[model samples]
Target chain A: MEHLDALENQSIYILREAYKKFKKLAMLWSIGKDSTVLLWLARKAFFGHCPIPLVHIDTSYKIPAMIAFRDQLAREWSLRLIVGQNTAALADGMGPERGRLTCCTALKTEGLQLLMAERGFTGLILGIRRDEEGTRAKERYFSPRDKHFEWNYKDQPPELWDQFKTDFDADTHIRIHPLLHWTEIDVWEYIRREAIPIIDLYFAKDGERYRSLGCWPCTGRVKSNAATVEEIIAELRATNTSERAGRAQDHEDTYAMQKLRAKGYM
Target chain B: MATDIATPRASSNIVIVGHVDHGKSTLVGRLFYDTDSLPEGRYAAVARVCEETGKPFEFAFLLDALEEERDQGITIDTARARFHTARRDYVLIDAPGHKEFLKNMVSGAAAADAALLLIDAAEGVQEQSRRHGYLLHLLGIRQVVVVINKMDLVGYRQRAFADVRRAYLDFLAALGVHPQAVVPVSAREGDNIAAASARMPWYDGPTVVEALDAFAARPSREHLPLRFPVQDVYKFDHRRIIAGRVEAGAIAEGDTILFTPSGHRGVVKSIERWHPSRTGPARAGESIGITLTEQLFIERGEVISHLADAPRAGAELRANLFWLGDRHLAPGRPYVLKLATQEVPCAAAGVSGVINTATLEHVAAHEVAKNEVATVTLALKTPVAYDCFTDIVETGRFVLVDGYDVAGGGIVLPPVEDDYTI
Candidate 1:
């Protein structure tokens, strides 16, 4: 309980700080467990209201169940949802037939970039955990992106204590990651504690479950019998599988994540 | 038991720091391997990579997350990994001990609840080791566990461990850092890592795992004096809600809250929660919004506390600082001081007692160079509310922002009597 409470409080503090600092800020919701938990924490911080706008870059290649869950939550929670898509890329017949990296770059990163340009959102909150990947492990809680939307990973600014790099040039974009400290198991444990609703696709159906959710064509499922949050926690405790083992994009290359993240793939 | 399985036990962030080539990475790798914390696929994955590269597998290779670092066979930055004991979970922070990576080391150590200071038994104490010890103390890391690693290289003798331990302990003791335990470990040989080593028959002590479990989490700040910082004010619907996190103490309805530097006070009308019905006292670490009985025109960056025990309000304060900027931190250089929620223009009134961390000697310098720790007197343009870090850290710690980057971090020390030329 103490561990969950600690994680929750720190996240809430970060959310409040982001909300207080940035005038035009939005949160990216991937309809995954981590970002969903981030959404829940936003409500907790704002006292039942998500003051920040929620952004979802709908690549249109997502599994149908994910879209349904997103819509359902948007309507039920009365969220200020803004869905953006690379309609032009989709119109050009971009699919997995193209390179996965290029597809992701155009549909996800470029789509988000276009959305940011259109909305003029200065700050964006993401639910990226360090333990999820290697490049993510070296991230700062309040990382700033350049005008070209690149993570300057090589010479990152020093982030000491709770004082993050909040101030940036007018053209500089900031990415706030409140869940950077939470591990994959911690996310499941917090989900169990808070009883936060998640897409049922995570639960096992006929000996298979999605460990990490993404767009349909690029995603995979693992053999699992975790039909409930408690079962998932137990499975996580006993299993040696990485959380992103079922996510396909990460397997394309050794530095797939680093390359993707450097090009602004959150 | 099912509930216990469902809920995670409390965790601590432990940072492992030492000189480069002193086995910090090997120790971290061994800790995870010994505890069976590495996922089976991950272990096999690294081994497979080693095979492809035609290099023998090493425990340190388990941590080379980046391909560049793998090629160099060195950890260039800080990375965190998780391992659990039967008692609790641990977030093991592996910090690079290279001199060029001191900024990375500080970044890692700043977030840790405790530290594991590693020393090479065969090589004895090193320069970077002393620097790291000084930085740990400067960062206010109270709990430390000294690990004499690579004992097997010295034939697992107690004499090597004792000599290194005694020397480092004396140095750390001078900085007021008394370690919780001095562990003798050979990460490569797996001696005194998971359990007490059978080879070191002359030494009787808890193993590395046991010593780790013994380090307690940071003390609760609930009983301390109230020091809530007003982060922002929101007007949702019709009610005016003031939002902030209780950094030190608790706040309840009807408690008179004092906003500092502005000298405005108001009584708490109601404790606001998301449910709107769950009203209770908000304690330390809880982010809550409250409605005041009177609508006070208080802005962000004001410390809220009991009027009887408010923070020290002044335009100047002394600090023990560590500079991380490329440009030297010199006197009269304008920078932004960010303390809690307050941000104001400030300058180094005087930079003094510049410490060469490696030598532990006070070097005469007018400016602090990169990665150097020193004492500084900062002069702010305006008065702000703050506390001595020795008393309440949340309100006492601050960062110096040069342009858009966080260039330096420090703790508020008691004000000095001498004047600063600024």
Candidate 2:
């Protein structure tokens, strides 16, 4: 019953700890409810100020509303927003028209990979949760991404207590998942409780809402009248639907997500 | 045995462990099937495969059915499945009990909230049953509920059940994990799985589902010194944000906080939870950010604390080691030491000794064998903040990496009291 308070408190503590630990760090903002809430946590963590760079890897194929909303929040919060993109791939005509996995990699993962290299960013904060995927369920709060940006999902370290394996060799950036311990329902509940600002995509527009956010070409809309955050939480409670139901690459194969992760796809 | 009670559904991880061919997967599969948590149409495909392969259609068929597993009728890796009781949702980790997959077993057990120790009544206790219990104990899994499985074979005999219970308790006691409850069931024949069995009328206890519902949750301590591992630092405009999860205790406005390893110091300018619209006091478990008074050497992996109370300071820590890697761990071998988010090059210097997990006795040995538990003093190339895994399991525990792989994991056992631990 008190797990919500415990979950929140733990997240806040992690935010503060990351602030105190890594000097050169940035956070990955996907503009979804989870990361957006992570943004909200950042504001709370820094006392109404986001001090780290909010890096959003722009595939340039995202929903226009997402772009608009991102800019709106960036301006309002005065965030040091950094837009990352794989410009070359786009120029080459790579699109979801090719393949879901190929599109995601060239855009989200590859774009972020290029941004990370160009900026020399060593630590990237993510809002991924364990319950989101089976492979994700095995990740540590402080997981390491290799120099090649690979996630050796099979062999993860033992994260006993709160001690995470944060130290890695040079060129190896760490991926901090503060939301790894949270669930999908917990995210919406927190959104409702916190009243965090979200894009209109989540709310039903013509009886369809984006249950999960991704690239516009790939992300599918689910039928719902859950116009409010509270309603979304209620819908999730009564169903056993997977949170990433709208995500494309996860369903291409049984372990497509794992394969993508191993290849450095976030 | 079934209650429609929902406690807002926090996730609970349950690791299913038992000897090979003891129906660990079948038990998990049955639970998934009965709870309606399966992918809806996968059962028929599993049944078709069984028919095509001439293998019997059973609950154990729920795994991905790897070729090796199909050939041997055994689980290979730690396959996982999710189910929900009325009380809460359960992420079940199905671990192979065979010695070959011991590494896989430990990986699964590491993330579990509790364990379901499945012992076949027909076979009684086996090598893996004892080994897993020992491993679970070494890994600090305090809650265990023993399932006396294959009860239909013995017709759910009370005496047979009691005999196995007593023997396993002795083995478990040697590993320092005592079973909280012993429930008899048959993974096959649908006996005492989702529903209670009619065969065991004399025995009165909560069924497996009920026992899970009754299993005591790990209590959070808000009184401990504030220990937060810095996960990330966000800098927007002119303000810097420090983010992490609260491992223990609580924080508020004006609290003086310190960062270790980096050794940065600052006061909490404001207390904010994850709520964006309205800022207020924050508690444990929430992954929110924090603002400090002065910009310090803050980054990912270092533990932040209130300046009033500093954690037990040490670059060199004595830890309880459990080797799960393919390579044997030796002293003077440089490998990666991971604590919190901070990873540093560390040497397993002065292998002060190894612990005999079977007897829970200290065997003054330097050479640590694979899959064996040991006690050793570790020296880090760079000093990092850490507490004994006992005082702060969240911050005290760490894993060792050889090259790019996680080689071993150990808990900073409270400084060996009298060097006698089981």
Candidate 3:
């Protein structure tokens, strides 16, 4: 469909924007359908070769299949994969048992933060969509983060038309979300149309499927029998459930995601 | 309601706005729900959050999942959701409609292609509805499709829809917006949203979906000249990369581009995406990295482009402004001016005359309150690559920041009259 092509072109355009705007850049790969699609788009934006580093936060608690899939794609796609982790926190025994927010902060945010410092990265590309959560709604396509990685939610640059604010002050690194305008269904339909590779968790097995991927300890499965991509599309054509319903950290409080994101948690 | 328009190029972003409880969030929620765009398990995430926060679980979760929004039953920030008709992709921005969150509304409206102005059928055109319409006009959002919501609440009465439509048209006319069409529907009852409502068969206009699907992509002022707002100058490993979107027109390798405000001239050497080794020619709406053939220290917010059609470099610009700050604006006060990626210290050169947005009449000796639109003069300490808003909107738009916060938005007016000295 032309709409799909248009969305794809828009995403490729934004990806090209980020690549142009940032010098020491990296792309986040969650091993999910969205970021995987982002990875594929990045390759196309750069003419079949990903010039930026592929960053996958090794929370150390991710599902085993996710880690396997990550490595497999890294090899097949010739990706510059950089696995980051909160080694100190993980060594200190930070787990979901402590708390969902704390766990996510240490494993996800802290992991990325430490990686940025150690690697001297100034820009991060995420596959976050505005429709995924309310706090994400406040995000700019070219959003700037403070030195401390704090997001000033109340104070945002005016993004009129497509002219996004890309320049920033010293020590003020930015995060670019090229897929901020995409939705959950759009990602899948693109996957089906483009035939991008996805992890096994997304497809239902034994009448249960993991709709959203996260730490194995905290993620839950929902009822579904859509084993193939076509069946999944058909099922998605009729369901009302949110894509992130099974994730734990988003459920801790009404503003749980907001609070985490305000402190720079993805 | 289904009238998908064919789009061959990049799709435009459209935001839907109205008063709180007037179905701003509900309309977006319904759009996602009906399109089945809501991802799997997303509802359960909200349900779990609702169970934790003791909030009622419903489709509003699709928009207001933030704790503050849920607690207040209000939208505090601008939320974006996507929908695709057979013709084009639409980015639906659900803006907060409450008076307290007018700034959010302004930000949302700033990014839209066309606006769906929602009016409560029973309420019959309120103040915020008119205010939003006026704000949309000030922001230069030309296409408007009015939706008279809550028809079910009014028993699908043609009389109620007609009254609201009539009142809305008069208000919009006062604000200088002649909307393309006005449709009546019930967002709550799922009437005339994605499907035609049997109840409103007497109404001969397009439904919300049809209006959106049928709308054409408005072309920018690309043909007039070229304007590129520099977001930043990337200096990594000593390789200079001037990065930003081509706000209008296109750029090719070896084209002489001038950085405005800075008054620096350079030749285009190469355009790259993320790496130094890769390069190409960049076009409008696409962000590509550029390496100058002749390197100088160029910072963000400076407009870089072909020297042949370079925009005027100036410190002072006469402009139309939407004031969102609580404090009053006056001449001689310095606020932040952001053009593309450039943020510079700037002073309001003259109060000019504050005009009433609703009436479009100039008023003398008055302070602009929050949510007021006025014509003002801004004088920057440093030069910027800019053009008059009427001539080219790319370089003409800017945002004012005070103490690290964006205070208001601005559109460049015709160059200041000949008599002014900074």
Residue A34, candidate 1: Cα error in Å is: 1.5
**Who is ahead in DockQ, 1 or 2?**
1
What is the CAPRI rating of model 2's predicted complex?
A: incorrect
lDDT string for model 1 (B161-258, tens) is: 88899999998877778899999988998999998889998878889999999988678999999988988888867878888888998899899878
Residues B55-165 of candidate 3: C-alpha lDDT, one tens digit per residue: 676667778866667777888778776667766667788888888889878878887889999999988777788778888887778899999988988999888888889
State each model's TM-score restricted to chain B. Answer: 0.96, 0.90, 0.87
Q: After the best TM-score superposition of candidate 3, give how far the Cα of residue B27 lies from its true spot, in angstroms.
A: 2.8
Candidate 1 CAPRI grade: medium
Give the per-residue lDDT of model 2 (tens digit) for B312-421.
Answer: 65668788778877878998888888777677899987676676655556677777887778877888887888887667677778888876567788878665455644
DockQ scores of all models, one per candidate: 0.65, 0.23, 0.30
Q: How accurate is candidate 2 locally (lDDT)?
A: 0.76
TM-score, cand. 2 vs. native: 0.80
- CAPRI docking class of candidate 3: acceptable
Ranking by TM-score: 1, 2, 3
* Candidate number 2, chain A TM-score: 0.96
